[model samples]
Target chain A: MIGATRHYEIDIDKVDHMSKQLTEEEKSQIYDDIKEFLSEELDVPADQITPQSKIIDDLNGDSMIYLELVEMFKKRFDVNVEVRLIGQYFQRHPIYTVGETAQAVYDIVERGDNLLADEDKASV
Target chain B: MDQGIELVELSALTAPGVEIALIDIERHPHLEDAADQFLEPDERARFVTLRSPHRRREWLAARVCAKLLAARKGLIAGPHEARIAQDRSGRPALVDPAGRAVTGITDCSLSHKGRFACACLGRPPIARVGIDIETVSPRLRSLRDAFVNPSDAMEFHVDTDADLALLWSLKEAYSKAIGAGLHIGLKNITSNRNPATNSLRVRTLAGRVAHARHVVYSNCVVAVCFIAQ
Candidate 1:
C-alpha cells in the first residue's frame, strides 16, 4: 500500500540559502536525517520520499507528526523551534527538495549558535 | 429566586450595626446587566470598558456592596471608594486605601451562576472568605488526576457514586481563601472531611484553614474558607 503512493524525489540543489549559506556536505546530512524520520514515521520506503511532498497531503502527517519531527530536530540539532511557527513556514517556503528543509533548519541552528558564541567571546 | 436556580439559603456575615442584604435577581429588577448611574466619572469609564460578563460581575458586586453601604448611611460613598485592592495573586480585596485606620475590615466575595449573582459581605468577624461552586460533570471522573491531589485521590474513591466534582470545588475554594489562587499548587494543600465540625479541614502552606463545605443541586458543589483575622 505504501508503494502505491506517487514517489517524488527531492532535488537538494534547487534551494537558495542567500547569504546564510550551508555547505553541500552539511546539506546532504540534513537530507539523511529528514529521510530517516519520514521513513519511520510514515512506514514508507526511503526511495518514495520527496522534498515537494506536502507534509499533510502527500506524507499523511498530522499535528502529532509535526510535534514528533520538532522533538527529533531539537534533540538531533540542539536548536529550539517554536511549534506554532513550524506550520506557517512549511505552508509557504516549502522544503521541495530532500536536503533543503533540513538544510534550512541547520543554517538557523548554526547562525543562532554562532551569535551566542560571539556574545560569550565579547563578554570574556 | 431565579426559576431555574434553587436558592440555597445562605446566611450573610453582617457586622454589628452594619446592614447587609441578599437580594436574588428574581426578587430585584434583574440588575445583572443594569449599570450604576451613581458611579463616579472614573468608575463609569472603567465599568463601561469591561467587556466580559465575568469581569462585569466583579465590578457589579463591588457596586452592589457600595449601594448597600450607602443605603445604611455608611462611611464609604461608593464600592470603588471602599478601599478595594487586589492581593498578590490578583484576588480582589476591600482594604484601607488611605494610611488612616479603616472603620473595620469590610470584605466581600462574589459568586454567580447562570443568571443569579450573589455577593457575601462581612466585617472583621469574618476575616478572609473564599467560596467556589462547581457544576458536577462526568468529565471530573475521567480527568480526576489533573485536579485531585495524590493524597486526596484515595479519599475521592471514584465509586459508583463519588462526588469528585465537589471535592475539586472544595479544593479550589480553600486555595482562593489563602489569596494564593492555583499558583500555590493544589497538591500543597490537603482537604479532609472532618466529621466532628461537619466542615472540611483545608491545610494551607502556613496551617490548616477551616472550611465550611456544602453540596448544592445535584449539579454543583460549594465550599467556603474561613480564616481568622
Candidate 2:
C-alpha cells in the first residue's frame, strides 16, 4: 500500500467550467473508455458492463483491483491523481455503479486537487 | 452453523505429524482482547500500524488462529509462546518465544475471508501445507476467465458460480502451498475434479502435483492442500 499526505480540493467552479466544456460525445467516449478498460482488466465481456454495473459486486474486483483501476484511469485520462485520494472519494461517496465511477473520474480530472484535505470526513 | 472454532481432523489426509484448525473469527469477539495477550511485542506494534479497524481485526484473528494451531501441534506450549511472522516475500514463518524458527515445522499457510480463518501446520516429511476459505457468491463467477483455465473448466465441468469459487479456492491453496502466491498465474495451475471420490487433483506450472479437498461450512468454502516430500 502506498501512502501520501496532501490536500485535494474539489473546486466547484472549475468543475462547473469543465462540465460545461465537456460535450455529450466526449462524456460518452469517456464512459466507453472506462468500460473498455474494465473489460480488458477484468477479462469480462464488454456487454456485461452497463451504467448500473457495480465494480466490486458485479465485476468481482477486490480492493487491490480497485487500486489498479485507479492507476489505469490515471493513465487513460492523463490526470495526475493519487490512489489514496480516489480511495477517499469512493469511501465518502460509496460509488456503486459504473456510471457513478466514470462521473467520479471526470470530477477528478476537472476538480480533484488535494483530495486528502478532507481526510477527517472519510476513511480510506 | 456453529460459530466457534472447530478442529476438523483430516484423518484420511493427515500425515504422521500434521494438524489443521478452522477458526470463525466472527464467533470469537472475546479473542480480540485475548489476541493482545498472545501477540509478541513486535506483532502488537505492527498491529497498531493498520489503519482500518476491519484490517486490524482480521490481522489479529489470523494471528490468533495461527497461534492456536501451533499450540495444538505441540509446536509451543500455548498460543503466547509462538509467533507468526512474515518473511521478505510476505510468507509466514513460525518463531518461538526466543525468536527462533521452530524445528521440525515445514510450512504453514493461513487464509481468511469474511468471518472465517483457517491454518494448516505440517512437520517433517510433509514439505508444504496450504489452506484457504472463501465465501461462495456470484462475484467469483465474474472472474472465471481471468483465473480458470479452459482445461480446468472442461475437466471440472464448472458451470455454476459455486463451482468457479471452488476452483479459485483450490488454486489459491495450491499457490500458497507452492509459496509462489499470485506470482504464479492462477491459470498455470490446472485442476481436475474426481466426481467419484469428491477430491481435486491440482498440478502446478512446475508440473508438481497435489491433492486438495474442500468443505463447506455455512456460506463459506474451506480448501486445504498438502504437498509431501
Candidate 3:
C-alpha cells in the first residue's frame, strides 16, 4: 500500500537537484535506507545484505517489494517521477541486486521528474 | 485429488472457462508431515532455498493448491511431476520436468491469505488466469486511497470494508493475470462492479477486459479472473 499516491505534479524547474546529482553522503544514506527497508520488509539480517546481493535469488524479494521501495523513495525524496516510465526502464534494463537498485533510486531522486529522459537512462 | 475436487463446489465461484481449487492451509497437514507426498526433488530443492519460514509455508501451501488441481485434472502423472515456476516477470506457469511449460495449462496462478491459498488454471484460447485471496478487515478499509480512485466506480457504493477488500482482490487478480502484479501501478487496473450479481467487469487501461468471479469463503475474499487471447 506504500506509494499509493501516484498522481503528483513536480515542476521540473523547481526540483532544485543541487546541480542535478547525489552527493557522497546522500549516496550512503540511500544505501542505508535500502538496507533497513529490505531488512525489515524481507525479515533478513541487515549484515547479510550487500550491494551485490540479488534481490530475488539472494534476498527472497519479488517485484512488489521493489515497487514498495520505489514508493518509499517517492515519499521520502518527494521526487514524483513517472512510475510507469521507470517500470518500462526496468523492463529494458532490469536492476537485479541491492547496489543496482540503490543506484536506480539515486537516479530516480536525482533526475526527479525527468527519470525517463533520453539522456537520463539508468546505468544498471 | 480429494482436497481439490471437493472444494470446487464450495461456492459458485466460477469464471466462464476456468477451474479453481482452494486449500485451507490451516486444515491441511504440515509440510514436515507430508512434503514428499507432493513435492518433487527439484521442487523440494527450490523450497529449501526460500529462507523465510513464513514464506516457506505460504509457498508450500500455494504449490500444494496448484499441484492438487493439476493432478485432479490429469495434467500431470502426479503432484510431483509438474512444477509451478515463476518467470522473471513473476508470472507462474505449470511446467514439465524438463522446465518447459506444460500443455493444456495455459496459465496457473497462486494466492495466499492468512490461512488459505487458492490455485487457478486455464487452457489455451484463454490468454491468462489469476487468483487471489485476501481477508476482509479494517486493514483494507484504511487503505482506500491505495486501490480505489474517484473514476473507478460510480454507483458501486464501496460502503463497507468487505467491498473495498473485494476491489483490492479484483485488482490484484487482474494484475497477476496480466503478469505485471502491482508493478503496473494499482490505479492502472480499473473495474465497474455489477451491483446486482456482485461480479466485476474488470479492465485495464490498455483496454483488456477480464472476467472475474468473486466469493467470500470463511472470511476471505477470493477472486478468479481470466482474459481471452
Candidate 4:
C-alpha cells in the first residue's frame, strides 16, 4: 500500500499558489495539520508521534494514506503535485517520518510540480 | 474470533495452484528472536528498525502468513528458505535466502487490516496475482465515495458496509495484482459480480481480463485476482 490510486480532477487555482513560498508560520501550520491528520488516519495518539516517528514502520502508514495526505493539502491549500512526482521524489528523498512528510507537503505547496532536494531549500 | 482458519471464505478467493491465507495476526512478544528466524537479513534489519510494537508484530505476522501459505503448498522447506521482499513498486515479493528472485512464483502479495492478515502466492501460469482482506465495518461504507463510483455500488449491490468492503478489496486485489497496489486509484477499478460463475469481472493492472473472485467470512471481505502473463 505504498502508492495511491485516487486522484482528483478539480481545477483549484493551484496555479496561483505555485512559486509562492509559504512563510515559516505557514509551514508550521502545515506541519501541525499533517501530524494531526496522521494521528487520525493511523489511529495513533498525537503525543506518540515524535519528530522521528516513522510513517510506515512506526505509524503503520500505507503509501496510499500518504497520497491522501497529498490530496488533502491540495484541497485545503490549492497545491498541486502529480502523484508521479510525489512517487519520484520519494524514491530519492525517501521520507519515513512525520517531520519528513510535513516538509514534503510544504515543498509541494510552495513548489507545486517542481520538487527539489531538501538541501535546495532556499528560504528555509 | 477463531484462530482456527476454515478456508471456506478464503477458498473462493484462491486461484488454482495458488496458496492463500487469512489468519489472526497475534502479537509475538519474542519478535526480535522471531524476526531472526522468520525473516531475511534485510527484512530483519527493517524489522528491528520498526518503532511500533503493533507494527513489529503485524510485520512478523504477515511474513508468518506468507511462510505458512508457501509451506502448505510445499513451495519451500521452511521459513528461512524463502524471503519476502518488496517488488519494484513496494509490493511484497518472494525471493530466495540469497536475495535472488524465486523462479516459478510469478506473483504474490500481502495485506493487513485490523487484527487480520492475508497473503497470496501464485505459480507459473498465474503470471501475476493480488489479494486483499478487509475487516468489514461501517467505516468503509462511510468512506465508500472515496473509492466507489455509482456503477460499482450498483453492481456489487452495495447495501451493507461489508459489500462496500468487498468491493474495495476486489479493486485492491486487482490493483495489487497489477503491481500498482494502492497507487491505482480505487475509483478507476470497477467490479461486476457474476453469480453464474461466482466470480467478479475486472481489469487487471496488466490490462488483461482479470480472473477475479471474492468471498465473505465473518465480518471480513477477502478477494483475489490473477492474470496470466
Chain B TM-scores per candidate, in order, are: 0.68, 0.88, 0.89, 0.86
Error of 1 at A53 (Å): 36
Interface-residue RMSD per candidate? 16.5, 12.9, 4.1, 5.2
What tens digits encode model 3's per-residue C-alpha lDDT throughout B121-187? 8876777888888778765553465457666667345768787778878888988887874447666
Q: Give the poorly placed runs of model 3, Cα more than 4 Å off.
A: A1-14, A17-19, A38-64, A93-100, A119-124, B1-10, B98-103, B135-147, B153-164, B181-183, B195-197
Residue clash pairs of candidate 2: A7-A114, A8-A113, A8-A114, A8-A115, A9-A113
lDDT of 4 by residue, A1-124 (tens): 1122333343455445547667787777777777777888788998888878889888887655676777777656655555556666666567878888888787777777666544457637
**Positional deviation of B2 in candidate 4, in angstroms?**
18
| Candidate 1 docking class | incorrect
lDDT of 2 at B21: 71
Error of 3 at A14 (Å): 6.7
RMSD of each: 15.0, 12.5, 5.0, 6.3
Query: Candidate 2: global Cα-lDDT?
Result: 0.67
**Which candidate's DockQ is highest?**
4
- Worst 10-residue lDDT window, candidate 1 chain B: B1-10
lDDT of 1 by residue, B42-133 (tens): 45666665544444554454456444443344555444454434544446554443524236545545454433344444466666666665
- Identify the superior model by TM-score, candidate 1 or candidate 2: 2
lDDT digits (tens) for residues B67-123 of candidate 4: 767766777777778889885667777888777766667677887776667788889
True contacts kept of 2: 0.00
Steric clashes per prediction: 1, 5, 0, 7
